[model samples]
Target: MSGVEFNRRLESIPVYPAAESYGEDEGLIKLASNETPWGPPPAVIGAIQGQLETLNRYPDPAKSVLRRRIAERSDVPISKVVVGNGSCEILLAAGDALLEPGAEIVYAWPSFSMYPHLAAQSGARAVEVPLANGVHDLEAMAREVNAATRLVLVCNPNNPTATAVGIDEIDAFVASLPRHVAVILDEAYVEFNLLQDPGESIDLLSKHSNLVVLRTFSKVYGLCGLRAGYALGTEEFRLAVDRVRQP
Candidate 1:
């Protein structure tokens, strides 16, 4: 698939200028991107500096430090977390593992572009559900699910729109889905959720075995460049995603 054509979609995406390129003297308040100007804390920087001598050595493939921390914080088991290059890598890994030609991937439109990109890259059909006032309508999304549906994607506290579907509502949606279908919760922006406790999703995972919760170091940790994120779920599901990930 290396030689696969990208077609016109990639061409259509607008090329916005980087905020970093803005002149130092401009004093621009750039909200066009939500990146945190202040990144890792002083202690984190000091720790990284201490590890600079070992930078030449291969980093942990399992990402033990990050994974254990996330597991302790998330309340999901360690076996459930599968860390990858970034949130995109985890989603793309989901694509590589599950998507096949003619298979279906249902996602909310205008939520995240990567959902469609991964769907296309896997040569699968992409079903984009329209948002209702910037929130995902789980009922409408459920209507699109069929036997051929390989994955149903939900980007909560949705990107570009930044709205959340509450825990009760999200749980109801997961319960409503058929057991055969997999539901991926894309909670990339979840850390900064102001309306409710972010840990609610972790609790929901126990009910729906097919649910895969996605998280990232990019958004809250402010480590998007570090290319680290993880997916948490049952052992079977993590292994299901791992087969596509392992070289």
Candidate 2:
């Protein structure tokens, strides 16, 4: 044994429960990871294949082209966009950039497993409010916010349960929080949301500078292997998180 010491804070963080694998099982349908039933479009496959010849070179560190496309689609400025390996990376970066010891991070319990892990990894206190009727209890979450609170993560169309909070409710929730607290709206499965309009959440960014919305191409777009995702927020927020991102 190397007798190497890991970060002691890891002792308090629970292991993320990844979905069990059924290796090489034919004709089996797996829904645990929220992957798309179909493969990516032919054009997407062609684009990726077309780039294979340039594999010797590193990708654009700024990801300017993709960021510009995403910005145009989201109707946000390109400076406001920060791309990541995946939305999960964006989440982790947000925690690293915003969370610290004595700071508190709030999110709905029984929601995404990453929230608790992110809090522990950052040495921040986690305030996990129990979900109400399989959905995020926004009011309870807002009440948990105190002066110590630095980050709030709302997983709309929340994992495991697939229920989403409405846009009006989100607007009210943001309006209730203090400006110092940054809110992360993780819309990882938003494309699958049929109950309410998914685009409405992006509109909140204009009204709340402290709010950021995260999206990924992994779910509906079937690009899980590509690990493409991004966050839309103010230029200041993007810069903060970008500083913590890997080159």
Candidate 3:
């Protein structure tokens, strides 16, 4: 195929996920959704406090400090990092940066709905392949990916269900993918993902230039309110994502 022939489902979607209710004035524990419960580390708090003096000034739009902190922790080089208001911003930025008018985004249906939503916003087609056996079916996913697929999402240790494939399984699946098609591992809750070794994605990036890994301080570092998150990959992919950060 010479790319997608149609794009209506994603391009014309009208609804966006919104708060079903704006309930009481902060009186709920909000366990309806999972949260870190523990906030940012004391050191992070100190750093944010130090920045309080410059609150009137614009925040470093590039977010160098937070990126550097994330790089230091993740062991990826600082230049390979890009920061945003929240992980969703980075995810949407990836969608905008990577997806063209007819590019197809392939992700699991009961996984993260945002993959398709962001694709719709960018006029890209959402190729939602169904889940299998309560976990990501690597073979099924690979079969669905065609030449038109620009991005493939692997939400390891998937949300709600919290099931994950083995590290080798993930690596093998990534190895089967096209080098030019972006493969994103949404490891947002990896801190709680007791299944596989945490270092797997970092390992994958060294070999696969197409690999993208997303992590957030809102979960393990416990700073969702502060809206800190990042997408990790080779510098090339990060640059591709950064190109769309402007309003």
Measured by lDDT, the strongest candidate is: 2
- lDDT per model vs. reference: 0.83, 0.90, 0.80
User: How do the residues 87-168 of candidate 1 rate in per-residue lDDT, one tens digit apiece?
Assistant: 7888988888888888998999888867877776777888999999888988999999998999999988898898888888
For candidate 2, lDDT tens digit of each residue in 1-247?
7999999999988765444454666676766677777889999999999999999999999999999999999998999999999999989999999999999999997988778888889899999899998989999999999999999999998987889888888899999999999999999998878766777998889999999999999988899989999999999988988899886
- Which stretch of 10 consecutive residues in model 3 shows the poorest summed lDDT? 16-25
TM-score of each: 0.87, 0.94, 0.87
Of the two candidates 1 and 3, the one with more favorable lDDT, higher being better, is: 1
lDDT of 3: 0.80
Question: In candidate 3, which residue ranges exceed 4 Å CA deviation?
Answer: 1-29
The per-candidate count of clashes, in order, stands at 1, 0, 0
Where does candidate 2 stray beyond 4 Å? 16-29
The RMSD (Cα, Å) of candidate 1 is: 3.5
